[model samples]
Target: MILYTTTPIEMIFPCDQTVFDNYKTISYQGVPLVVEQTDNHYRIVQILSSNPNDFMKEELAPGQLISFI
Candidate 1:
């Protein structure tokens, strides 16, 4: 997987709850996000963040996908 540090930390998964739980929160001086165990099927660029409130806004939903070129 690639390591993103832009405004919107782009990820290729839907923030896996199980996998995410394994990781401790890392300070970034910016928005923080995690991959959902429910969205491990994705294999592209899936952006996630703490500001958009995907969890609260359903921005990522249970399974969100994105394409990377």
Candidate 2:
């Protein structure tokens, strides 16, 4: 079936609560980001900054792995 809706897919097909447990919002290098914890680093989930320049940084790109000190 073809489903057309503005609602996010996650809301339609809810994910497990445990799936969200590893995700968190943090300020990295003064930029707000949503990241998922991996073995030794965090995988960028989303950039929450309003500044366009924030998106220009390759290190902060979504899906990039970052090690937090």
In model 2, the Cα lDDT at residue 41 comes to: 91
RMSD in angstroms between candidate 2 and the native structure over all alpha carbons: 4.2
Which lDDT tens digits does candidate 1 get at residues 1-69? 676555333232536655435432322224343332223333212334546554454434434432222
Best model number under TM-score:
2
Report the CA-based lDDT of candidate 2 relative to the real structure: 0.85
What local distance difference test score does each model get? 0.38, 0.85
TM-score of each: 0.23, 0.78
lDDT minimum window of 10 residues, candidate 2: 5-14
User: Model 1 — TM-score against the truth?
Assistant: 0.23
